[model samples]
Target: MSFLSFSPCCVKGGILPGVPRGDYDTSTLKKVGGYHVNSSDGMIGDGKVALVIFADIFGLQVPNCQILADGFSDELKCHVFVPDYIPNPPPNSAFTQVAKTFPEEYANRPWYISLIEWIKTIFKAWKWIPTFLFQGNQIRLAQAAVDNLITEGYTTIMSIGYCRGATILEYLLSSSSNVIQCAVLCHPEPKPRLYNHINRPTIWNIPDHDTFFKSNEVDILKRIMGKKVKDQGLEFECFVHKDTVHGFANRPTLDHEATKIAFEKVNNDAIEFFKRHLLQ
Candidate 1:
């Protein structure tokens, strides 16, 4: 999913997606400048704040991410942008090949068929080498998207990343300062080491069994992000959603009760986190 690695967990997480709430409307959105824009034009506030969503590998195509973006815009009455920062997001067919063939998702398939599919998946991964190697391009494209927003008169810019997109956001925020005001990472890709620097207020919406992060790794992220920043008001805090999988927040498994509840809670928490760190 990321430029660094092909995450099987991310592939499996894309199998079954949950439905977005009926009230979260996104009927009029169209791609503009390589991104989808959601806005309310200051219906509730001054509309000076802009939120950027670095979506999962599915990017702009994922319904859950789109709905979540709409929910943020509708709730906050601000501008929200979902940028396609990377190219050739592995298709649903790829996820199907990887997930259905994997034992965790389907145990009833014939061994020979599974083996064939597994081999095919391996070949697919090798083909993805070019995609992962383009992280630099992804960052450049993402940076331009954020910079363009700032140029458009948005005073406060906040961002959230899901899955592989989180990996990119981590690098973006670590390398640049004073760009994003605050952040919420939903099911972020967990790294083994601390980032070079994290200067913005960030919250991690961690799932019980993260697709990318292990328990100890999540603890490590908590420790790294939990450190209090001088005068940032709200510091890094990781909210663990219990009894859920890695993509429970962004690519919900519609049948699971826990997934639904966690999705709502994560969205609400993110909205509140953004509000608390307003530049005004």
Candidate 2:
């Protein structure tokens, strides 16, 4: 996890692979507990274990995030929630339009076209960029949402986050305030005091070459987490996928075979993770 850097190129992401498939159906989406929930008829889990998906900058509106929420809900047999923590979308604009639908919009686009459009997107989305970058309010909302879930009687809760959501997940993981038991982070740009606070098991799905988290920093994070597992007996694992870039797991371009593999790998790994942790 290239220390989940806040580099200039964080805005310039790579191919987000996979078309929505499996149980990633959107028809299951509904409103529950002040969030967009993926469930059938508003029921969440067996009132036992549940999962929370902290979404990327694309927020809960994008198919990318919805797919994850829905798929995880079905596979894990646990209801999932995507909090509407990012409030008040900006005035309609080209960037907002693309952010809302980049999964389908860029599905077949060539890398060059995607690059150009995204570069343009950065400039066009000036109004929204700051919102994604400064997630102070969102962080509070997400934390409170989890607290509310616990108050509502969910016995076990786990979370997985992508990019911006990863930043917030780290905040949750490090806190002593919640009973959150596990985490899955995809290409997260982790915050400072990196290993100081995480109180539970965490899994990382990161790319080998990504401007977002950097290769050098990945080595450092992996090393520290490995030591924590040994010295503190807390579980931790990381997968540095070869020949991929940042955002590959969450929003892969799918134009390349490696990216497609990366996407599937992430999904499979997360399922196994939750099954092992939550089912036991």
Q: Which candidate wins on lDDT?
A: 2
Q: lDDT per residue, candidate 1, 26-68, as tens digits?
A: 3222322544445544543466678888877666655656666
Regions more than 4 Å wrong, model 2: 1-45, 89-119
- Which lDDT tens digits does candidate 2 get at residues 27-120? 2123223344444434434657778888776665565676567667667777677766666543334554244222244567677877887888
- Per-candidate local distance difference test: 0.66, 0.68
Per-candidate RMSD, Å: 7.4, 8.3
TM-score of candidate 1 relative to the true fold: 0.77
Total backbone collisions, model 1: 1
lDDT of 2 at 87: 66
